[model samples]
Target: MPRRGGPPEVNAGSMADIAFLLLIFFLVTTTIETDAGLDRMLPPIEPPDQDVVIKQKNIFTVNINKNGQLLVEEELLDLRDLRARAVEFLDNGGDGTCNYCRGGKDASSSDNPTKAIISLKNDRETKYATYITVQNELVGAYNELRNREAQRLYGRNFTEMEAEFLNPETPASIRDDLKDKVKAVQDLFPQKLSEAETSASN
Candidate 1:
C-alpha cells in the first residue's frame, strides 16, 4: 500500500507518565533554601561565672513615661540637654573613659571621650515613636562622640577635606592608621541598653 506505510506508526505512550513522575520526584527531592536573618550577639542563658553586679551610681537611667516625657536620673530633662548632661557625666573625673582606657586607650588624655552605661526605661503604654526617638537621640550622641574621637586621632577633618585626600594616590599606611583610629573610637561605643533592666523598670 503506499510503500507499505512503515508499520502503522504508534506514538510513544509512556512520556507523559514519565514527565509526571519526574515532576513529582523533583517536588519531593528538591531542597528549599531558608533565609537566616540578621546576626546578633546573644548572652548565655547560664554561665559558669557569676553575674557581676553593675553599680547603680555608674548607670545613667533614661525614663520614658506613657506621656512621652523624658526623665534622666528621675529628674525631668529636656531631650536636648539630656545628651549633653550624659556626656558631661562621662567626661567628669575621667570615669567615662575608664572602659576604653582599660581596653587600651589613654582616657585622661582624650578630649570628650568617655563610655557610660545607658539604661533606658519605657512604660508599657509608651508610644513606639517616642521610644524610637529616644533611641535615635542616644545613637546620635554615640555618633557625635565617634566624630570627636576621629578628629582627635586623625589631626584633620576628613569630612571637610576634598576627595583628593581619599584618592588611590594616598599612602596605604596612612589609610590603615586612620582605620585603626576609627575602630578605636567605635570600640568605645556604649553597648545597647539591656532589655532585662528596662523590662524590670516597667
Candidate 2:
C-alpha cells in the first residue's frame, strides 16, 4: 500500500505573483483606447450685462432631431453637404468690410467670419455621434477659412503657425511673432459656436 501524499503536494505559492506580473506586463505593453472628447473652453458663468442683438442672416442654425436627421436653416440637409454649406455661410462676406474674405458676397448668408455664428440645437435624445459629426463640420468650416487666410498672409497654414507657437522649444522672439500671427488669424475668423438648451422631443 502506497501513502497518499496530498495529490503530490502541488505548490500554489507563486501563482499569485505570476498573475500579478502578467497583469503588470499587460498594463505596460497593451494599448488602452480612450473615449474622444472635444477641447472646448466654456463661457463664463456671468451672463452679459447687455443683450447683444445679432442679425438673422449672420446666424447659421443647425438642428438635430432624436432620429439623427439634420435640419439646417429650416430645411432637411444631407450630412455630406453640411461642411460646404457651413463654409459658404461662414465665408459669405456679405459686407464689403472683410478684405480677406473671398466669398461671393451672398446677401442671404453671413456678413463675415467675425459676424458668423453657428447656433447648434439638438433634441434631448439626439444621437451623440450625430451631434459630434455636426460639431466637427462647423469647426472644419472655421479651420478652412483660417487656413486659407494664413496661407495667403504667412505662407504657412494657420494650424501650423499655431502648433509652432504652442511648441515649448520655440524661441521667445519667434514665439512672440507666432503669437501675434496666431491671434491675428483668430481675430479674423473667431469661432463663435453657440449651443442652446436641449429641447425635448415632440
Candidate 3:
C-alpha cells in the first residue's frame, strides 16, 4: 500500500512557549523608559529630635500678586531694586562680627547672609510667567550675594579669571567650596513666602 506521503507534522505546542520566552527575554534586557522630573531638594519627613526655633530678625519677605506686583516688607518695590534691597536687608546693622552683617572689609561677615524667607502668594488666576519672573529675580538676588561673597573672599573684586574659576569645571575641592557657599545662601531663602498680602484695602 502506498501510504499518502505527508509533511512531517510540526509540533506547535512548544511554539507558544518559545514566543513567551523571547518576549520575557526582551522585556528583561530592554531598557525601560522612565520620566525625568525636576531636580529639587525636599525637606525631611522625619521630625527632628530636638526642637529648633528659627528667628525672624533676618527674615526678608517678598510678595507677588497675579498682576506681577512686588512687595518687600509691606512696601511696594520695583523689580529693578529687588536685588539691592535684599542685599541691604542682609547688610543692615553692619559690625563685621555678625554672620548676617554686611558693609565691612571682612569676607566671612558677608558670606552666609543669615536666613531669608520669601513669601510668594498668587491668586488662582495668576499666570505662570509672573511666578517665574519673580523666581528669577529671587535667584538673581542670590547670585549677586554670591558674587559679593566671592569678591570679599579673594580680597579683590571678581575678575574674569575668578568668575571662570567659580565654574563647576574647576577642581572638585574648589567647586565643592563654591557649591557650599552657594548652598549656604540658597538654603537661607525659603521657597514659600508666608506673609502673603491680600488685595483687600485696609
Candidate 4:
C-alpha cells in the first residue's frame, strides 16, 4: 500500500487555483440580469390633477374577468374586435373638435380625443396573457390614430416620424420641425389610458 495510516496526504497545492478557475468559469457562463418588468410610462405626479374631475361620459371602460373574457362598456366582445372598437371609441370625438377624427358622432361616447380616457380593470385572478392582449389592442388603437394624424400633417406615418426625429444623421433644424409636428400629433391624440387596481373580490 502507498500509505498505511493517517488517511494519506492529499494534493492541495493547486486547490485554490482550481476553485478560482471554477469561479471564473461560472462568472463567464452564467448570466446575471436584473428582473425585467413590463415597460410602461406612468403619469407625472401633480397635486391638482388628481382633484380635477373627468366627465363620466368621457371615460371608456374595459373590463376583464377571470375567465379571460373582455367586456367593453359592459358589452362582451371577441378579442379580435377589441382593437377596432377601441379605435372607433377614441376617434369618435363626440364633442366635435377633432376634424381629423372620422367616427360617427355619438353623443354618449368620448367627448374628444384629448378628453377621451380608456379605463382598464381586471379581477385578481385575471390571466396575464389576456391582460396583455387587451393592453396591446389599446396601444395599437392609439398607434393607428397617431399614424393617421402624422400622415395628414407630415405626409408620413408616426413610426416614420419617430425614426426621422430620432435619427442622429438628421439635421438639427429638420429635427426641430419634426419635433413640433410630433408634439402636435401627440397633443391631438394623447394616450389617456387609465388602469385601475385589480379587484381582489369576486
Per-residue lDDT tens digits for candidate 4, residues 1-202, read: 5747666788999999999999999999999886534557786786673577788878889999999998888899999999899988988978888788899878899878988999999999998788888888898899898998888877899978978998999999999989988888889889988999988845
lDDT: the better of candidates 1 and 3: 1
What lDDT tens digits, residue by residue, belong to model 1 across residues 37-130?
A: 4333586788757767655555678888888888888899887786676555444434443533322232332232333567788888887877
lDDT of 3 at 183: 49
TM-score, per-candidate, Cα-based: 0.54, 0.84, 0.52, 0.84
Candidate 2 total steric clashes: 0
The local lDDT score (0 to 100) that residue 64 gets in candidate 4 is 90
- Rank list by lDDT: 2, 4, 1, 3
* Ten contiguous residues with the weakest lDDT in model 3: 103-112
lDDT of 3 at 20: 99
Ordered from best to worst TM-score, the candidate numbers read: 2, 4, 1, 3
Root-mean-square deviation (CA) per prediction: 10.4, 2.6, 9.1, 3.0
Candidate 4 wrongly placed segments (more than 4 Å): 1-8, 32-39, 49-51, 163-171
Select the stronger candidate by lDDT from 2 and 4.
Answer: 2
